[model samples]
Target: MNKAENIIVGISIGDLNGIGGEIVLKTFEDERILDFCTPVIFASIKSMSFLKTHFKSTINFHSINSINQVASGKVNVFNCWKEPVNIDFGKEDTKIGEFAIKSLASVTKALKNGDVDVLVTAPINKHNIQSEEFNFPGHTDYLAQELEGESLMFMVTDTLRVGLLTDHVPVKDISKHITSELIEKKINTVYNSLLKDFKIGRPKIAVLGINPHTGDSGVIGTEDDDVLRPTLKKIKDTGKLVYGPYAADSFFGSNNYKNFDAIIASYHDQGLIPFKTLSFGQGVNYTAGLNKVRTSPDHGTAYEIAGKGEADENSFKEALYTAIQIFKNRCDYEEITSNQLKKAPRIERKQRPN
Candidate 1:
């Protein structure tokens, strides 16, 4: 790993009563993980120590008050709060929610100040985290508001990538939310993320239909034909590589997603169900279209097996690697593009002949 590319990954311990701490500790259990990036976990050292004891982990960490004090090849825990935290493994309480927000806020501040290069957030409980401070639907929305950019809920694994056009909206409200303008906006975000973040020169994007059978020529619905079709045509006309308002039902079954670099699903369930089904324990949820790099495990707070030491860490590990890769990719893209933008030698006029 190039020293220049070695990043400081900022982690937010989400819902202390859940498996967030467990999965995070498990991911870093192998010291080899420290080879790629320096990790700075934004949580209380006391909480982490408690969890470590419970999990019987031999992993050790350094506690620091500031990001500048982080050491290379060591897991650093940023002391966000000094108060002792009581961990009730399988219980949900307002105190846990308050601590979760504190952790997230601390880490996000580090991220925005360039103290940390990328952020790999552990799973957060949406309902519990909902307070006057954090009233957003989920992490994607909160990040978008904090970073001042539109966020695409992009799910990623080795084989496929899925983006949601409408996120965290009710089923009845989904159709109203799926306007042509919204579709175009989210699709543009996905396209730009592929280019800048993922370093894809020309990404082929597949847009899924809102209704089954792609509206069946207006038999089932006209949203696919009227809204989706025209929007795709407009985007394609601009020389962007995009295709399809493909029927959602058969698109994944036919394995047609392989042909495209990314798929834009109409709604939350329409996209996430298939993605989770395909990549349950190994996928990363990437918040694309932000200037900063952020990703998280696809799974949520698994309270059922929180303290049992049975929570799988594969997804969390993948999230970390994915965040690192995206950070490197963005840096490489900017360097290459900046060099390419250098003006070529301008033709000089020969006045000697005149």
Candidate 2:
């Protein structure tokens, strides 16, 4: 783990109408959260003030006009918007959507400039946020556009990690996007991320079939045999530890996922269904293959329960801790790899039967 020198984590408050602010306040109530890193929230004081009164949580809010005012162990608030927000809890408003996007843009800029170590985003309403400025399906696509990296969304729990090949896409269009090149890229991203970010050497990976019973020898669908099998073989030929085209139904049923480091699903639901079923309210949604670390609670905005003080902060807490752990692991792996490269020639000579 990287030594704690006040890791600054930039947090974007999601749709204020939802429970984003409530959960954020609840999660930080524990002073232990400040021990590992400083959390800077990109939100307006008005939104946070609403949460304080609604949730009745006594959290110190230090408003900052700029990132330069951030301090460790302090809940530094960067006021992204100057206007007052009248949030109707559990209601959908386009103004909240615009507010959410503003917060996102602010934190993303900080992340790109290295002012923040990791980004922990709260849930945003997709339909509400569909404006001229925010046209992406969700945060994953937005981050992909901003950072220009292969943004792969994965759900993380203490027990399992599942990545999606096609996220936030229609079920009918899933097969059209599942090309061999895309599959290989996603696998390579997962493989390299596990090695570099998770400190896993030669991580085992599992790929799920697009059809039932892995196409049942071409009886059900040709996608598994034609697209997935060939891609899996190619990945295997590269001396990487990968196994797949497993029947999606039985894969999660027989506990086969326990053997692999990560599983790549054909689409969003294929991966998210099993993952959420197993780790609901506790899973952390992580965006891998980015230049920086980004994680969010696996669940949605939960508009039904917003501002009722009913939102669980477990997933948010997990997301924060997971981001910190991945950051530390990545830093350590880089150091170890650098040292190994420096001594590789000498070690190779000693092992050559001198």
Candidate 2 ranges beyond 4 A from true positions = 1-4, 346-354
Go through the candidates in order and give the C-alpha RMSD of each one to the true structure. Answer: 2.7, 3.6
| Window of ten residues with lowest summed lDDT in model 2 | 345-354
Local distance difference test, each candidate: 0.89, 0.90
Estimate TM-scores for all models. 0.95, 0.95
How well does model 2 score by local distance difference test?
0.90
- Going through the candidates in order, what is the number of backbone clashes in each? 0, 0
RMSD of 2: 3.6
